[model samples]
Target: MAIRVYEEQGIFHLQSKGTSYIMQIVNGYPAHVYWGKQLAFEEQPHSFVDLPEGPLFLLDRLPQEYPQYGTGDFRSPAYQVRLGDGSRITELVYSAYRILKGKPQLEGLPAVYCETENEGETLELELRDAYSGLIVTLSYSVFEDSAAIARSVRIDNQGEQPLQLLRALSASIDMPRSDLDAVYLAGTWNREAHVQRRPLGPGGTTIESRRGASGHLLNPFLALAAPDADEDHGDVFGFSFVYSGNFFISAEVEPFRTTRVGIGINPFDFSWQLAPGEAFQTPEAVLVYSSAGFGEMSRTYHRLYRTRLCRGVHRDRVRPILVNNWEATYFSFTEEKIEDIAKAGAELGIELFVLDDGWFGRREDDHSSLGDWTPNPSKLPGGLTNLAKRVNDLGVQFGLWFEPEMISPDSDLYRSHPDWCLHVEGRRRTEFRWQLILDYSRQDVRDYIYDNLSEIFSTVPISYVKWDMNRNMTEIGSATAGPEQQAEIAHRYMLGLYELLERLTTRFPNILFESCASGGGRFDPGMLYYMPQTWTSDDTDAVERVKIQYGTSFVYPVSAMGAHVSAVPNHQVGRVTSLQMRGDVAMSGNFGYEMDLTRFSDEEKDLAKAQIKRYKEIRSLVQQGDMYRLVSPFAGHEAAWMFVSEDRSEALAYYFKVLAEPNAPQRKLRLKGLDPDKLYKVEESGLVMRGDRLMAIGIGIPAELKDYYSYSVRLKIID
Candidate 1:
């Protein structure tokens, strides 16, 4: 068994493929012991319960694995409780624990699951607040060949009166002082998920997304690493949440010199009422330990999320080369024009044609008809089916864009059901993108969206759906929920969205779904559970994308990144980069084009055709291989990255020079992640070279390349 428990020693050890996690109970309270490189130390029964004098007498000094409130610990609590009598203190004690043969499913939440009984095992630590009669069960699961420990909590209200839950986090970990530095993914809308590393000093650093999306500003990922650790070496501890709502992940240093990491729902505007016989389950948070450094940690995450966390028909399948019509034509086009673009794309080897917004509900711009789902006859004269058929006739798959969670004030749906939006009495409705967020917390609203989308899916032959949300929540009040439960709206909103997605994806299992929120605002693991890919950024400028993709690669794999080549003097950054550079950077991810094919010159069309043909050659390696960052764009003028196949027989490297310094010396690029003893033949030049020399002595780059220029080389094992 991967999971083992020793009652005599009160120790629980969870052993994954390459890592070990140890926890112990001291006087009915759990404390984290060790989590790092796997150790062979057996658990020998030893007594640590004898109360020591002075500062050690205080519970705060001990490394608690799951600390509670009101126990005089004075530190952050894993779960906070309030009683009917208005007491906010919780005195929790460990009651019992069960080691199960298989993992139990979390109710109303998405979590990683064991595919079979033999794949993994689970453990549940049951704790009780004696005075309040509140039972909290912490669930942990360890897989057979994975290093991720899935952690979550279940709070069952067994008392006579109702209880208020203020801070119910998914997981909290305690660590002894190792002089660790914290690393997290942070950025705003068009520039999301940039890696930021800093010292975990006296004060705490909190990365949260209260924007109701696991917002683009701060993704739900955090890491605590030793100060000397870099990308390829040292120990690193990673924590990531699987929920797509308002979340908080923090790394704080206590006065006692121990660092406590916490992750779960943001309690700022969150409160859940647990009635008698009811239970509340926090979203699952994954904890990974890598004594081999961040790259190994990333590979572990990439493996787990890509294979287990994500689901559906397209999970492991190659993503089609789709060209979205949003940047191509925005809100202006007709059925004939769409067919023309589809024809052009099909002629250029594009596999899918995605008809973006303004194809439905009398919509001309972002101002109107968001919730209406009917096809606009004026734009699509033959309706969706006819257009889809026309596009399919051209040998290209049909895709579409939809913003179902939004309702425009000028829309017919809002005109009929004004109470459907999220607004309180006597307040002017707030609007972003000229639309109001439909209160998904209302079952009727969710049913409306699900039914309408189901109808569209049943009628249209679409192979892809670009699901998008343009803005954050504004009013926060749901008309269907009770007044006392106002704080639950935000979380319920997320659950409702998940419910909708679950229904749609399960119903239409063959269709591929891509999540987008103003080009990556809602990009998080929670969304990845349902949608395999997310639009990496709205900024497609190759120069800006280098940094954007770089920061995102620290956590997300290239398979999850949606990159596209847009019109030059790029739509978002307005910097003109060569077609070669743009295509090279975009090909590092799920490659596609987001520009008009109707306007391209014969030469430009040839370039795009060549780019598409070339990408198809290395698509699998780029999508599924182990990635290595050779040079840091965060600290240098040149950006370089490499990907090696799982078997280490093939590799692809991309080198970009952002700026040309006057009289700059020729750069020698050293490749990584290749088998050192094997010889590789460069496909471009048919030149054979040893991998050791390629990495140690390096390859001489061309000096004729100037700024905004890029080069890519593919290498295969020759002998």
Candidate 2:
């Protein structure tokens, strides 16, 4: 059993493969005991600070499993609520708990799941406020195969009167020590998910996104590592929120040197009204502990999320080598031109060809026709059915792009139902990319989108869908919602989006849906539950992607990232990189091309064809293998990573140099995650070496490598 309870001692110990999280009920309050490397079960007195009496109670020093506001604890709390009497003071006492055989799903929310009953165990602790019939249930799930604990909270309004929830976070835990560095991912627009780290200080350190979506500014993830922690050594703790809306992850160091970590909905411009018998379920928060290092932590997340969090037919399948027309033609292309590109992509062995924007309602550019799902007769003569067959006839599957959550002012949907957008009544509606966000918080709006999309999906031969949200929310008010429920718009929008996706993906199980928010804006686990992959970034420059993709791998698997090679003098970044470098970088992920294949020279075409063929041969290995990031792009001018098959039968290593140095010394790249005793043969050089020597002694890198130079070396077991 992953979860063990000591009822006599009022203690609960949850164990994963490599770690244990222990908590105890102290004076009717659930307090955190210890969380670290796995320990043998033993009955012993827990070490705790003696609480001082009266007003100066040492509640702040007590490590709490779910701390609340208005208590003696001065640190950030896990939850806050407003009672009917208009007071925010509330304290919860332990009521009851249950140790279940399997995990329970969060109502109307996405979370990590257990395929079978034996894969995981769940513990639910019920705490209640005696004064007001309010109940808070903190649920924890421990998996048998991964070092991760999934936590969530369910608040039930048992009282007769209504109450407003001022703040509600998913999970919180207090660590005994505070000597660690806070590692977070931060970036904006074209550059997303850059690794940033800083030492933990006495005060609170927070990374959040209040831009409606998870925003490109900050990811819903945070990690605390020992000062000396690196890729291969020391201890690290990672927290990832399984949500897609505005969220905040915070770490606060109290005066006694104890650190409390919390993550969930941002609680900024956010509130929820719970009526009698109503309940609110916060999104799940995943906690991962790594005594081995950040690399092991990443692999734990990769394996768990890849298999448990992501669902549907595509979850275990290799992503198609696609060619998206967004960067190639933008909004300017006709039926004939599109077919030409598809023909060219088919010749280069691309499996899927996507027709991007401008294939809708009088659409010419980004300025118009967003919510219009129908194909534009001007660009696509016979609509999507005709265009899909044209591309499908060229021996390539057809894909499409849709910004369903957005509507342009000139679009027919907006003109017919002007109040369907998210805007304050009588206030100027904010327009981004010449479009306004649809009020998905309403059922009618979701129904309209579902109806339209279902029609198209049923009629066309579409094999893939790129669901894009180009802009974040502004003037986030729903015309149909009451004033008291206005604060629930953002969260409700997310729930509605999830509901829509569930319906669409369930109806069209075969279509591969890739989520995008201008790029990596809405790249989060919540979306990943519905869509298997996401466009990693709009910036496809090979040099830039080195950092973007590397940073993303901290919490996301390579299979969940949609990376593609674009044209030279890259559309997002004007840096010209070699075709080899671009292909090498893109091939490291769900490989694809976003360039004009029809314009490629004969030599370029031949190179692309070879790249496609190579990707086909190694796609499964790359998608399903364990990844080892040898060198970080942020730390030096070179970046390298390797992938080893789970069975230890095959491996691939890639090395990239951004710029050449004059007379640089020879360097050897040490590999990881390989069978040390196995003899492996390098396919490229026809050289054989023992895996132990290859990893310990390493392989030589090109000493004369130039700027933007890269290479991928494949290894297989010797006969």
Candidates in order have lDDT scores of 0.87, 0.91
In candidate 1, stretches whose alpha carbon ends up further than 4 angstroms from where it belongs are 41-56
Model 1, 524-584: lDDT tens digits are: 8888888999988888889889998988886777899999999987888788889989999
Q: Give me the overall lDDT of model 2.
A: 0.91
The residue-by-residue lDDT of candidate 2 on 516-634, one tens digit each, is 99899998999999998999999999999999999999999999999999998988879999999999999999999998999999999899999999999999988889999999999
Clashes of each: 1, 0
Q: Which is the leading candidate under TM-score?
A: 2
